[model samples]
Target: MTPKRVVIAGAGQGGFQVAASLRQDGFDGEVLLVGDEPGLPYQRPPLSKEYIKTGNADRLLFRNADFFEKNAIRYLDGRRLAAIHRADATVELDDGQVHGFDHLVLALGARNRRLPIAGMELEGVMQLRTLADAERIRTAIAPGLSLVVIGGGFIGLEIAATAAAAGAKVTVLEATDRLMSRVVSPAISAHFLAMHRASGVDIRLGTMARGIRDNGRGRAAAVEIEGGAVDADLVLVSAGIVPNVEIAEAAGLYVQDGIRVNDLMETSAAEISAIGDCASFPFGHDGTLIRLESVQNAIDQAKCVVQRLLGRPEPYDKVPWFWSDQAAFKLQIAGLTAGADHQVARPSDDGAKLTVHCFRHGALIGVETVNAPGDHMMARKLLALATPPTLETVEAAGYDLKAVFAAVSA
Candidate 1:
């Protein structure tokens, strides 16, 4: 039974992929993409990096107007889903438009998590999530301005580096001792810590940013720390994000950290599938489910779900990969690095390249490469192998991933 009408909520990258993939895969169905934001779907990663400096909003667009018209996609921008009627297979938008759907795909992305700290209401404090937010920061940033970033994650560090390069006095306050502790190995964290500090950016580790201090004019004056306040003309909160799953939960779907979905990306109820950041899909590891916020997950899961709807039911199992560009360094990672008990760091002779291999129970779990594109590409190929080389094989190869990969391929 081919679905006639397919409604996808949240026109972010995932939702856009689902709609585009459906048409590209020869599905002659009605595709409706409803987005809360007004405009074409754009790339978010550059909002903090390239957009902060260049302000080229036009380059961020995934597709222009003609693609939608040619593909016959009914795009409803500036619309939010109010409720989902699972029984009737229809969704009501905030504008009171009830659209019937043979299949509903929830590509709802995540929103920035606002921490409960004082002085967050200040005028100069902001969070980078949308194009409008980036515009505000680009207009506000200037040479000799004091910028304080509250988180030391990839986004915060990348923003810090960009600001510093623009002649802004950048300061990063990380609550944890190691930078990117939750994702990367300590070796990779240490490398970035040194790289950032060498670029004249002040980085404070294990330092909690308690609150923002307000200026007399209702603006941010400084960021209050354990010792004292640091003067801040602008403040950026990169405290991570929370998945948007309220609509799914309201419709009585199972919700954990995110909207829970099966291997086929189907939700608790049939004819409804969930993908992207809002979906916690089964990982085929120890029967546990993990939600990824990377672009790879969004694109791959969308394709997987569309295939299922087209009667080709293949499970969504793809290698996870992520990348971050800070200053001159590009860090790329493959596979899940969580719960890794051991790490082996390999640095080039000139100190220009490095890769950190993470192992769990003597098996390779993940690989993090800094400024090494070749290693990063090989790491992804290696991880996709059914039986990746063990820690011993890697050690025997003198921690040379290229040689290890070549031998395995041989």
Candidate 2:
């Protein structure tokens, strides 16, 4: 008997992983990977930092041409999935080809949110989300150039650090009260704000970009803040990302915050599912729908869907984790803390490392650490266990989170 065909839209991090995982699980199906971007599948995280600083495009490619062929995966590059023909169980591409699928996966991922302001069409204005975007920014970075970044989120700060280190005068304009306000604690935000400032990057908090001005050369020259103008040779808008769900919505699929998925990453429609940044799966703790854009979420969710397709009835319940490399600090987060009610910090003896414990109504929910990988690893392990150590226990153990867990288990 011939195996069924599995068609995936959006050849991004999750989409590629889904294809690879399906084959790894011994699914002898015709796997089709469709993407709008031209070229092989690549990682997006390095686009802001390492790729921008060193311009290494090769490292971003997830797999070479041989790997795709060896796995019998059909990679449809440079073609966008225009619509999903649910009744016929086929995906209509922009080039007028309809590919039938026994199972359909939507891993469309997310795109950088464009700011609505004047001079956004200027030549030097860029948004770093794809390898193409990173390449353009890499060519633009030069010594003595002034760069103004809008938004103080992870991408903005990382790009600012890279541009500043490359000899660019960088200024970050954030409308928020503090940097990383939505994710990190006030203490962490203050620490990062000082880090950027000390690195010669002018970080303007509570400053909104009203508009952009051109330098009469069709290039962005200055960013108009709330009251003043900051001169910039280039402007990078690193605000945030919005999930790409137009195809799913057009196909009559349910899309709330993102394409709603069940524990198995299955969508409301039969034979169809969604994952990665384009998917809003169930949060185990609150039973609320949550969409995560991290690589870990994408990889884990893809594996879960593949397992389900391979006759394994496993619900996706993996803990969410993420990491950001900024300057000399490595920030790691384990689990989701959206509804965290209390937070406690355990500073290291040298004051160079810190671990924050987040609790929700007296139950440990998440942990954030700066320059503390061991603590972050322990937090992930402990959070998975039936009972985790208390915040007081973590502190009383001399900030040895792992030792605290070991002692409790012993």
Candidate 3:
């Protein structure tokens, strides 16, 4: 049965992509893309990087208004989805408008996790998840001002670097022992730590921020940590994100860490599907479920959902990849490194490039490369192979990624 209309909730990258891909697949059904945020869908990655320097919000738009009109896709901005009536096959809006759909897609992305500490609501303190948040950050940051970042994740580090470049006295508080400890190898973390510190970023690892000190004037005065406090004019809470799974859970969808989905992106409820940051699918090599919060993950899963909706279901098996740019350094990772039992680190002759090969039970599972795009690309190809190159082969090649790839392909 063909869907008469497709109502998609949460108009982020994944939601927007679903509507466009559906049209591309020749589905002329009524497509309604609803989002709580005003204006068209925009890329969120640049909110911490280019948008900080440029401050041009127009450049962040993923598609112009004409594209939607041209494609006959209905876009509803500033409209929140209040409820999903599965039996009625309709979604109720906060405005009391109810729309029926033959199929429903929940691309409801994640929201920034809150910092559960005193003075969280104080002025000059903010989180970076939306364009509006970034604009606030730009307004708060200035020359010679004190900026304390609350996490060592990508967004926090990126913001720290940007702030430092803008002449702000920057300090980073990471609860873990090393920068990006949960994601990258320790060697890569050390390299970035040196890079950021050389650029005048004060990094404090194993530091727990107990609370925020608020000035009587209604602004964040400092971040209170163990035994001391770091004075700050602004605070950026880039701790992490929580999936927007309330509606899914309320609708009785299978909700675990996120909305549980299968390889085809179908929710436990047959007619409903979930994708993007909010969907936890069994894509892990060990069959463990996981959700990714990257643009690549959202966009690729959106395309896969379209294929499945068009009666050409294919498993969502795209190799996961991610990148983070902090100042002049670019860190890239190919494949998942979650449970890697061992890792091999290699660096260039000039120490400008580095790569870390991760293995689980002696099988190559992932690769992390810094300032080495060529090697990162090769690593992607190598990991995609049916027979991944062995650890011995990688060492025998003397960490020459090209040679290792050639040897394996030959």
Candidate 4:
């Protein structure tokens, strides 16, 4: 059955891509891109990086009003999806606007997780997941401003670097022993730790922020730790994100860490599909079911679902990749490094470039690169191969990635 109408539930990157890809694929059906925000879909990454540094919202947009009109995508901004009526193949908006669909794509995305602190609701406390959040933080950043960031992950550190560069008194409080412990390797973490510190950002490792102290005037004044508190005019809670899976869960679809989906990006319901950060599918590398929060996953998964709907069903097997821009350093990862028993760290002569090759069961599985774009690009190709170069091969070649790739292909 041909899809006459496709209603996308979330208008983030993934949802926008689906609508755009469908139009590019020559789908003339009714494509409605619904979003909670009252504007065209924009890139979320720059909200913490480029947007923070330049304060230019123009660079964040994925498309303009003219593009949507030209492509025939019915974009509904500031509209929230209230319910999914799967029985009738319809979705209900919060304003009671019911729209029927032959196919429904859920790109609901995720929300910033809240800290269990007392002063969380106080003024000067912020979280950055949307344009509004970025605008809130933008007005708070200034020279000599005391800002304390809780969580040393990519978002936290990125904000810390940008704020510090902007002459703000920035301090990072990471509960973990190392920065980005859940994602990057220890060597990469140490290098970035040094980089942020050198840039005048005070990063405290293994430091747990128990609570936020309220000022006498009813705002967040300090971050209370074990023995002392870090005084701050601004507190950024970048603890992590929680997927917006409530609607899917309320509809009784299989919901785990995210909306559970198969390799084909199909939800428990055959007619409904989930993609991007909100969907937990089998990891393309190791087949370990996991959800990713990256632009690569969002765009690739959107393309995959479109292909399936267009009668060319292929397994969602794109190699996952990610990048973080903190000041001058650009850290990129080619694949999942989780559960890798062996890892080899290689660096350039000047100690500026690095690549951490992770191997599992003697096979190259993932690579973490810092300021090494060439190696990062090659790592993605290597991980995509049916037979990636082994740890021994890389070691024998003196970690010459290009040579190993040529040898493997040859």
Flag regions of model 1 displaced more than 4 Å.
none
What lDDT score belongs to each candidate, Candidate 1 first? 0.92, 0.88, 0.92, 0.92
The worst-scoring run of ten residues by lDDT in candidate 3 lies at: 283-292
TM-score, predicted candidate 3 vs. hidden true structure: 0.98
Question: Global lDDT for candidate 4?
Answer: 0.92
Ranking by TM-score: 4, 1, 3, 2
Count: clashes, candidate 4: 0
**Candidate 3 residues 1-410, lDDT tens each?**
76778999999989999999999889978999999998899999899998998899999998899999999999999999999999989999999999999889999999999988999999988999998899999887899999999999999999999999999999999999999988888888999999999999999999988999988898999999999999999999989999999999999999989999999999999889999999999975667889998888999999998888888889888888999999999999998886788888888889998989998877778999999999899988988887788888888888788999988988
> Which pairs clash in the backbone of model 4?
none
lDDT of 1 by residue, 1-410 (tens): 77999999989889999999999999998999999998998879898889999999999999999999999999999999999998888999999999999999999999998979998889999998899999999988899999999999999998999999999999999999989988899999999999999999999999899999988889999999998988999999999899999999999999989999999999999889999999998885675879999899999999998998899999887889999999999999999887789988989889999999989999888899989989888888888888878999889888888888987888
Model 2: which residue pairs collide?
none
Model 3: residues with Cα > 4 Å off, grouped in runs: none
Range of the 10 consecutive residues with the lowest summed lDDT in candidate 4: 281-290
- Candidate 2 displacement at residue 297 in angstroms: 0.3
Candidate 1 accuracy as TM-score: 0.98
Task: Tell me which of candidates 2 and 4 scores higher on TM-score.
Answer: 4
In candidate 2, what are the lDDT values of residues 120-209, reduced to their tens digit? 899899998888888989999898999999999988888899888989999999998999888887767887898899999999999999
lDDT of 2: 0.88
